[model samples]
Target: MTTQNRNVEIEERHVEKKTDSSMVASTFIKYTAYIIIFFGALYFLVRYVFPMF
Candidate 1:
């Protein structure tokens, strides 16, 4: 019974770790996409819109 309980606790810890890692990965992807979009927009503005002035 104790061994089974220990196994269950270990499994829970592993699942928590996996969920944390996935959350971090998702956050990284979201922020990276935002950064890329911002830089792309800035580049477009500088290359075309600014030059028109």
Candidate 2:
């Protein structure tokens, strides 16, 4: 019974790790997307709007 309990605890820890990793990955992706969008907007203004003036 103790061995079974130990196995269950180990499995729970592994699942927790996976959840943490996925959360980290999602946060990274969100930040990356925001940075890309910001840079793209900046590029557009420098390339198009600046020349129009």
Candidate 3:
């Protein structure tokens, strides 16, 4: 009985780990767009604004 209970607990932990991985993937996808836009704007500033001096 203890072994069975341990197996169930392990399965629950695996499920929680899967959900945590998905959350990380979702956050990465969400931030990737912002990161791209931020770098793009920075590039534009460097290309256009710095040449004025």
Candidate 4:
């Protein structure tokens, strides 16, 4: 019984770690996408949109 309980605890910890890692990866991807879009928009404005005035 004690051994089974230990195994369960270990499995739970592993799952928790995996979930944390996935969350971090997703957050990083989201931020990177946002940054790229922001820079792209800024560049476009400076190169083409701004000159129209």
How much is 8 displaced in model 1, in angstroms? 30
Worst 10 contiguous positions by lDDT, candidate 1: 9-18
| Model 4 lDDT tens row, 1-53 | 35443433444444443358888999999999999999999999999999999
TM-score, every prediction: 0.64, 0.64, 0.52, 0.61
- lDDT for each residue of candidate 1 in 1-53, tens digit (9 for 90 to 100): 35443433343443443358888999999999999999999999999999999
- Ten contiguous residues with the weakest lDDT in model 4: 5-14
Per-model CA lDDT versus the true structure = 0.85, 0.85, 0.83, 0.85
For candidate 3, the TM-score is: 0.52
Candidate 1: stretches off by over 4 Å: 1-19
Model 3 C-alpha lDDT per residue in residues 1-53, reported as the tens digit of each score:
35443433444444443358888889999999999999999999999999999
What global local distance difference test value does model 3 have?
0.83
Per-residue C-alpha lDDT of model 2 across residues 1-53, encoded as one tens digit per residue? 35443433343443443358888999999999999999999999999999999
Clashes of each: 0, 0, 0, 0
User: Model 1 lDDT vs. the true structure?
Assistant: 0.85
Off by over 4 Å in 3: 1-23
- C-alpha lDDT (0 to 100) for residue 16 of candidate 2: 41
